[model samples]
Target: MKGIPMRINVLQHTPNEGPGMIQDWSDKNGYEMFIYHPYQFGYLPTADETDMLVILGGPMSPNDDLPWIKQERELIQELLNQDKPIFGVCYGAQQIVKTMGYQVTKSPAKEVGFAPVYRRDVKFLNIPEELNVLHWHEEMFEVPEQAQLLFSSDKVENQGFILNHRVVGLQFHLEPKEDNVREIVVNDFPYIKGSVLNQTSEEILQTKISDDNKQTLYKLLDYIIEK
Candidate 1:
């Protein structure tokens, strides 16, 4: 690991919602990791300092009237312009789409808990066609122009998308850990209203451990880094 470059930065939007499995992957792989919390810390890092940028999931919507939302969007645009490797999850995905000139809106059906994502016909850098992934978001993002659609759910068509292979946005929680899912269910359950909130904690536990999904996520990460 001496010659290996280790420069990975994870932009965390919320304290409770930091990188879950991604952190583990990075640590085990000897990649140096840094967390930039724009919400509480009020400091944003320059895109040039980071090799890869991972925007983690959060409870707030991208359309929310928060100053940090705009700041984050601007940083996303800058990163996109630099053609840096970027990965986004849930709200982070929405922000990526919004930064690329697409709109993020509330989905017709609130997608909470585990959901199945059908692989699209389009081939990613080397991603699989179908996989079940963890989902816990009320909002979904519109596919931006020139972005390749990756995965889709029955409720939400735009579950995952790729922008020129390097930039990927996923609506599902590919990096969700057991405790992360449980914490979201316990603390963020009240915010999830309607039928989406009907699922019990037991049901959530069952869905988070889909081995197939975790394998697919590893494939994705490998592809992203290699590409």
Candidate 2:
């Protein structure tokens, strides 16, 4: 008999910020994906029913005291308690850090558009020393205790981290394709400012989406799930 497929529960905040390349990854891996819009439906899956939980990016800050946000944090905490695998992006990353008793504050600068993240003493995970990836967040998470710092950019000290070798949080977006980048730029251009680290809307749209970024994202997902 064929084995049952793993279920990936996605917590989506807004319509514009979908799973991007993660959906493709799930399909390729034969994992069943169930996207939940807690803002609209006010419902979330329990840790028992979810094989993997994906927390996608959004414009809202994880510091918001909204009911749905609180509930989502609770769900994330339960997942952590059960040692379930989780992958978090942008605001989702902040949520994970916040759930782990850390502060989510405004970043030094709004890291918009494509930027290079340097590897920061990360072992066991095979990633390039430097990689250009999409970043469109104004708030960032403080690295939690006992978490391995993965990558860091010039503007953001905590670009990524891994906890218990199963939960991953990324401040930069490695799962965005060209179209996905376009949608983010269009929706989040207002946050982009004129700074050394920030990019203009035109520049953000003009930058090429590298396949290496997607491959890196896939590698991370595989690593977390197989752990």
lDDT of each: 0.80, 0.88
Each prediction's RMSD to truth: 2.0, 1.3
Report the C-alpha lDDT of model 2 over 1-227, residue by residue, as the tens digit: 99999999999988878998999999998999999999899999988999999999887888887999999999999999988999999999999999999999988877777889998887567878889988877788999988989999988889999888789999988888888877877876777875556567898889998788888899889988985
Error of model 2, residue 224, in angstroms? 0.7
lDDT over C-alpha atoms for residue 140 of model 1: 89
Error of 1 at 203 (Å): 1.6
Give each model's clash number.
1, 0
- TM-scores, in order shown? 0.91, 0.96
lDDT of 1 at 121: 69
Whole-model alpha-carbon lDDT for candidate 2? 0.88
Model 1 C-alpha lDDT per residue in residues 1-227, reported as the tens digit of each score: 56856678888877667788888878877888889988788787778787888998887888888898899888888888888878999988999998877899889788777767888866644556666667778788999889888889988899988777578889988887788877777777665556454666667766646666667766676667774
Off by over 4 Å in 1: 1-4, 124-128, 196-198
